[model samples]
Target: MHGLFRWSSKWWPGLIPFAILWVLAAWVSTVPLEAELAANSGTALKSTVLDKTQISVAGRDVSFAALAFSEEGRRSAVASVEAAPGVRLVNDGTRLVAEAKPFVWVAERDNVRVTLWGTAPLPASKARIVEAARAALNGTEVVDRMGLARGAPARFDAATLLLLDQVAKLKDGKIIVQDTAISLAGMARELGGREAIAAALKNLPEGFSVAANDVKAPPYVFQANKDPVAVTLTLSGYVPDNNVHAALVATAGRKFANEKIVDNLKASIGAPSGFSAAVTSALGALSRLSTGTLIVSDREVKLSGDALYEAAAGQIRAGLAKELPTGWTTKPEVSVKPAASPVDSTVCRQLFAQNLAKGRIRFETNSASINADSAGLLDRLIEIAMRCPTTAVEIVGHTDGDGDAGFNQILSEKRAQAVQDYLVKAGLPADRFSTTGYGSSQPIAGNETDEGKLQNRRIEFLVRQ
Candidate 1:
């Protein structure tokens, strides 16, 4: 028995090497099969929407796991691995991603920061959107509060990128994308920003449309500052178009002929109704002031300045609102300047001539009641009269040839008397003034044309030298 056991032990030691070789051969053979199975399964799922895909093989049994975009995609991924040439079975540890009904995304901005929240279709999509927001809002802080989801609309990334462009135009606001619809609400940073965004929406992808756009424009403001020290009328703010801009600049030249115009006005939309008329009238009031500021915001006009004299201040306050269009409002903060030093009758006559040449002292048709539109010019006349307090002045009134001579005579006399009474009421001495009427006899221009007729009616200040 001892001899037989010794012989068996020697044979067992010899067979150990063969056993090792057989195990090595089995392992080496299965490695290639497992690798081939994994490769084939992955290739099958290449066209599927899946995330965090993993495939493992142990003796040709496949373990497939992934987050799929849809239940069908998940089932197909498992089946693809099970059908692989060497795969015995698929473990099928796969799940559909969370679905968002009417998937929504939002980007909100306040004074300090812009925040992006809601669902992204994929991890790659999430990363791309956050990076895009940071790029667009360069200085502004951008926060990401987004997560992964399924059921995003088609062309989701393209639509989101386009909507982000509009966000750059807002001062502060929010933009929302729900499925294929987009909505925006906020205040625009610039005068025409609202329109620009609306125009841009036309280029959005075919499936998307604007559901609601409540973007409001900032105030439509037109401002003018009259600076006596600078001898400049600085016009700044908005105009409806280039034509109104040119007309305002020209009118400023005529009204403030002595002052240089510093035009800083920009052309934009959103001008109030009667914008040109309101601005023109406001500029006239501003011209009468030694220094003033005019602000027209929407339909409201706010004027602040020191008028040339006390009476002029009162007249501007009372007449400015009346000159505005219907539905327009005015707030005048007028004050009287310090009295100017007395001037000789020669200087006073020249001042009166300059004032009359700029504008006319108009009256109601056939009546001596002065038009409110003439208040600024009339105030200028009052200021010049105050400067020459000691001089006796003759106020002469004339008319065009359209009226009956007798009636024209009476009308002209009454007009002259009205001037004298207005000056007396403004604290000027009535004894230093005389009134006269020439009717249509002292015509400076022919009455054949309307332009000539306009020039024929005149009021002359003759300072007694």
Candidate 2:
């Protein structure tokens, strides 16, 4: 009895707490609980869109693919299988499954449960599904894989998928598409760059997104100026950086250069913001390449030697270090992409010289104030000049031979001067510009018809290196 008492005294401290805790737990579980006291399940998109599209917080379907999120925010997103609304209960719970169509899952926290019926549409449909779901239920958890809202379509959701793919590929600034026309809604470099993006997009089977910005002007055409990514290694005396630059050019230049531009920076310096990172990174990469040797080929950059094997590593670090600001360390991987949509000031100038080819802008009767609707295209041109600055140009204005020869000449000069004035006001060097008037002399189309005359009356810019 003495031994027992001693043992109990020594271990009783732990035993008492364990016994009390177990009993309390059991009691809590056994207590009657009201379902009304349970937490609420959030909301979801009740219906599917016949043609799957991006759904914004407003619940309206938009064509954009980008949807921003935060892990601790009001909502989150997931992918799942395709299950139409009011359909069978195939899979449920966190056993989340993914399909080309949609996902299926349930979300719960704080006794609150929200089952996302239309599993977020495949990556493609995600924008629309998430938008719709969030719009319908103010505070909702997004589950991937629930199916059709009552009135939504069950047909092809392919467009949504393609758009998602395009959006994903936007990192390199290349406009992505598989089929549909992807419009440019922002500024671009040379008109060639605009055309390059357009041409690349023209073959896409699925439609694409334009920048929501209003800088996109009409009369979209491609001149094919792919600016090659450039990295110049300044050789000290005669260590031969040519091989290195050559190799670097072979490796990255092809990616950036498409048509006429070998290096976007060299092509034109319109805005420092666009190429600032690229310039810094490229220069840093050039510095790193100084540490390695390259065997330059006609089209390939092959690295050799102990240092050569580490060329990519050296280049990435150097590029990232210089490109990113001090105190900011990069991931050691550098990726530079072209603009998604390019606005070619040079090309726009050309179009203006040619009267927007066919009604690109609506002008007032015999005036040069520019039409209100012409603002979009004009904005695009301004953007191009800002992006590509090395471009030297001549703004030539033309007129139809309807009025007196002298009057026509004066009108043509005023128009050319107007273009020149706008460019100069936008910070272009007046020295880089020269204007000429061809009063009804150089006509592409006939003067017999108003349409032909309109074509003849235009403002064009000849882009000189």
RMSD of each: 6.4, 27.7
**Candidate 1 off by > 4 Å:** 1-68, 71-95, 111-113, 127-141, 199-209, 341-374, 396-427, 436-460
What does candidate 1 score on TM? 0.70
- Per-residue alpha-carbon lDDT of candidate 2 for residues 195-230, written as tens digits (9 for 90 to 100): 444444444343333432222212221111111233
**lDDT of model 1 at position 317:** 86
lDDT of 1 by residue, 250-356 (tens): 88876776678999999998887899999999998998898899999989999999998877788678778888999999999999899888899899999988878
Off by over 4 Å in 2: 1-363
Number of backbone-clashing residue pairs for each candidate, in the order shown: 0, 58
lDDT of each: 0.87, 0.39
Candidate 1 weakest ten by summed lDDT: 371-380
CA lDDT for candidate 2: 0.39
